[model samples]
Target: MTLAPAPKPAVAPPSPHPRRWAGLAVLSASLLLVVMDMTILNVALPAVSADLRPGAVELLWMVDVYSLVVSGLLVTVSALGDRWGRKRTLLTGFTIFGLASTAVLWAGSPGEVIAVRALLGVGGAMIMPSTLSMIRTLFTDARERATALGVWSAMASLGAALGPILGGLLLEHFSWHAAFLVNVPVMVVAIVAGLLLLPESRNPAPGRWDAFGTVLSIAGMVALVYSIKQFGKEGAAGPGPWIALAVAAVTLTWFVRRCLGRPDPLLEVRLFRSRPFTAGTLVAVTTSIAMAAVMLLMAQWMQLVQGHSPLETGMRLLPTALGALLMSPPAPWLAARFGTRPVLAGGLAVSGLGLGLLPAVPATYPWIALSLFLLGLGMGSLAIASVAIMAGTPPQKAGSAAAIEETSYELGGALGVAVLGSLAAVVYRGALPPAPAGGGLPGPAADAVRESLGGALEVARQAGAAGAELARQAKAAFTTSLEVTGLAGGLLMLAAALAVWWLVPRDLDVTASHH
Candidate 1:
């Protein structure tokens, strides 16, 4: 035995698998599908509305239900992925997405389409978490991980930009059904490729999946988002929204308390003890807040104000997406060279300056394009924000960290739409010169004109010269609102940059293992 032991020679342990890059491609495709679905409907809404003929409330639900479902389930599905397998969860999500997207072919009614979208949301919830968590596992090196996340962020930017373009093209040739159908082919490829290329990864010692925490998280997020949506549309006049907000507050607070008390929490709240994590979360929140509502308003401006077709609108928006596509991939390299604090803060400042210029852009088309390009360039720093998030989290908590970052984004967007939209509405309403006393507009039509620029345009078309004048008035008011919104958004970006600069540590290494 002693002789045998002496004869034993050292042998090297196996190296990490070499297929991570291929796995990333698969994950990026899935993420694109999820994100593209969110924006595809924007350009298709009119077509869908014409076909489905859903009522006002139903139309809103159709547009918003997907986001609500996606936001509500992100945390629950992420935890489930850890308890099960990340790759398994991702595949299951892809299956659900494919089947549901295919089911869209059968959807005839508004309710059915909403149901399909909700199901897609369920699939999205499952897919999103798995992608980020798997990336953390696939790329063990920090530099590699940062690059992977850059690609990940680029896909997201590309997806959001891609949706409207693809939808516009599809709607030009086919029915609204083509929008959902497009998801099926991409998903089928994703599913097959995923099974072959994506390796299985999960928490080696993931404790119990907290059922209560899941319920709390889902309910709280859903209620919060619903309330925000209601506020955006109807403001705080209703007790319903306020009550929902209260419930969200209570449930989320209790959920947080439970997380803190547990030895192994569903979400690792304590990880936020690190400066980088907190700063990253803040960046996610602020950037989303500054961008989401403005983009929505701009889209309306392009179509309702400028009278552009959906295809034209998509084309006009291309500069923003192109800028993001160009910037996000290189963001990691820039951060690696200059450090995250400067890049992230500088990006925010640049974004802010770009946004500030939005209010001053001449109404001409070329100026608008220039403003959008600069805005995209500024927002591209989002790639660095993602790096900050993963750098601060331990590998074991990748799913949790991803869930939190996503939650911030979702909620921030909701808040942005609700809060800033309300502001725009206020400005629009205020700027509306008392209906030209002699515009010959009906009392009901006059009320409609006051509601929104779109309403004004429709009323104007029917009211003759007076209607034309009213359309001009409404448009001018809308333009003012946009200018105000742009300035507000700019200020927010600048503030975020300053805050991020202060929040991130000077020497934080995002590429290093948190463990």
Candidate 2:
């Protein structure tokens, strides 16, 4: 028999775009816009409340509907990006975001504002995943990609802290409309930059885009998020929430099964079969949950208990952002020197340590500063997780991988607010003094007082001495609840760290995509 030469191993194609770093800047900037939008409402809500005079339900919808729509549409948009083109999808998103934000100038009612936010969510859903997938295609080398993700992560951390500060600054001199107006200009610039610099990429073998699968994913995610939000607000007593939860479970399970049965799935969930991808996703989810819970409670503590101004609270939050900025770039270098498994597990442990210390702090600047720094430092692992997810995924499937990672974050954040917040609520209700039905307060007011610390304070202000005493008890109860939330979050982080360590391969290469 004639000897046949063995085929040479396949090598990754050289990046088609030379202006990689510049493209990264565009991606990072786009990501910053998306992350900031999630939080910018915090300070603007009071302004909106004053201007719109919305009913309580209307106000809640205005605050929450954006996220609900974003989470709901992420999977669908990401899948479409794979079929059409990531660059094309992203630029379209920029156009929509800019137009929607600019249109906010005409918003005259709470319903109109809610519609605007939902439109913004549509743009966000399109933009967010494209950013990550574009990064995957832009940076061909692993180490360079890690560095890029470091910058991406820093921007995310910075954006969260920046939102309140920016809102406060604008609301100082301008109307609430300025908040949305800011996005318009920035998004316009991003859209133009993206068109000039970003290269088109798509799945070379993308199959039929199933509308039914898209519907299932969107419905499941929206229902699940809404169910969680309602449960957090009112606890688990309503049939509406129960029905939504059931629908979400059934719909998501069916969707997953459909993907598994397909030759070219809507999402390449089989990627999770690789332990590294699975570990990275779990880490993403865990960090998001921990950070969300911590940020919410800490912000409340600063404003309500410590009596800090909005500007002062934002300034106090700088340490956390600073720590993330300082540590993120170096994380990739550290992981390369050490092993990926060690770095990931150790980072989570350090974060858990911070959570453990939070409840014991004296609510002073120095004490809170230490915990926040630790939390940010430990968050360094998130960059590593991003690297792992992208590196492990095929370049063609970047959209699916990006969608999965972002979904983890979105769901994690929502659950964090729901589950941990609920746990804190339970502790608060239990520790609070019993609200007698007819003792110096009306039934409606008493029920309101029991609902939240903010409500308690409002009632106290109206009731004078009686309210003052109730407020005192309420603060004490809130503090106790904070303790429970912190401690429980710490335990969960520790558990996640341990689980990741055990599941991740000891010699796993975070940079190279083996699986």
Candidate 3:
């Protein structure tokens, strides 16, 4: 026999244990809960307004405060996770979030609700970054990591899609309080599972928590988000919004300079030097802006305009969820074959197409399912592209990378709702004639009518024939405004798609690049 070559050293096989997967399951469940809560309460806004009697500004705050705080704190909390063990930080966050949910349920005033929502945001900041960081630690094998991330992404998308359904069910059967109360059971389960299953992990070079950076980040984000919100309410050129934006710019500039000088910064500004990373971040931001506004508008149309019960409205959205579910499983395969850039660009175009179709959906259109399915399919593709980008990032910097990605998501969403929602409000007001001075309306009711479409409708419903005519006119105006808003959102998505085509490389494999 030909001198047998020395047997090659055997390579060790991967671990067969299920514990690692269980850890991911626990983390994914926690993430699902956090993301679901972000939008579930939206469907219940009408109920909240009816019970809490919030002003227009207060109503906007109730919807946006959680996002603002979460976005502001993400970079800081993500840094904290690098210093402390990710598991410990995540568990602590879960506890805080659960308790805050209870507080939200019991909140008697709009201000109290806003405060609790902000607290929930703090917890969310800790939780979001930790989940992605833990996933990085749990799966060392590249292929396994991709699969795990796919599952996690699917759950996140599902949770967002399901929020309206769950909220609608709760509102139809119980009260608006039930929307928040629902989080309690989910959180309790997630916390228990996390403690039992999660393995602790931390960065080897965990740096000091930058307190000053934290303050600057929070202040800058709050000012920026608040300014955008104000711009939506008062227009972008308004003096008040302009002032807020200027403050935000100054604070952010200072924060960036401070980070550049620090040896170990809270947010590593160097990350953006990577073209792929920067492009990915831009894609995430624009995709969120494109989709979030549509979700908000659709919810309003289903509940306030069409008079559909919350449960019924949610049921109608089932097609969108189904489409997303179907799309998620194939994401990894598509990325592997086509490469991330092409897949991402294609997805953006598809999403833009779907959004463009929305403006054509007639009031009496019976094909709601088709419209939602198309939208979901497009968005689902974009979601996979985002995951691909994150997974491609360096392991050591996963937390910061995740924070950046999430911040873009949150900021984009806030801007979308503020800008698109404001545009719709302006058009609605312009189309409707002013209410009569003494049309048997109370001062508060008349004032509210001037401010909110929903409030105006409620007033009309309760005030008799004259009020009914006013309601009719207002409804027509609202519909027209929604159509215009949808067109604007569609055009923005188209622009984003073009941006992706121009910026992202055509043949780049995100997975291979990182490896």
lDDT of 1 at 422: 93
Considering TM-score, which of the candidate structures 2 and 3 is the better prediction for this target?
Answer: 2
Please, what are the lDDT tens digits per residue for candidate 1 over residues 365-462? 78878877877887786788888988767677889998988889898899889888899999999998864535566788888887888888888888
Candidate 2 has an lDDT of 0.86
Better by lDDT, candidate 3 or 1: 1
Cα lDDT of model 2 by residue, 1-515, tens digit? 99899999887667546988899999999888778777777778889999999999999999889889989998889989988999999999998999999999899999999999999999999998999999988888887888888889888888888887787788888998988999988988998899899889999999888888989999999999999888888778878888999999999999999999999889888999988889889999988887888788888877887788766777888787887888888888888888889888888888888888877877567977888888888886668888878878888899999999999999899889999999988898898877632366887888877788888889888887656678788888887887788888888989999988987889876665342
Model 3, TM vs. native: 0.89
Q: Rank the candidates by lDDT, best first.
A: 2, 1, 3
Estimated TM-score per prediction? 0.95, 0.95, 0.89
| Worst 10 contiguous positions by lDDT, candidate 3 | 506-515
Task: Give residue 250's lDDT in candidate 1 (0 to 100).
Answer: 97
> Per-residue lDDT tens digits of candidate 3, residues 474-503?
677777777777678767777776776676
RMSD of each: 2.7, 2.6, 3.8
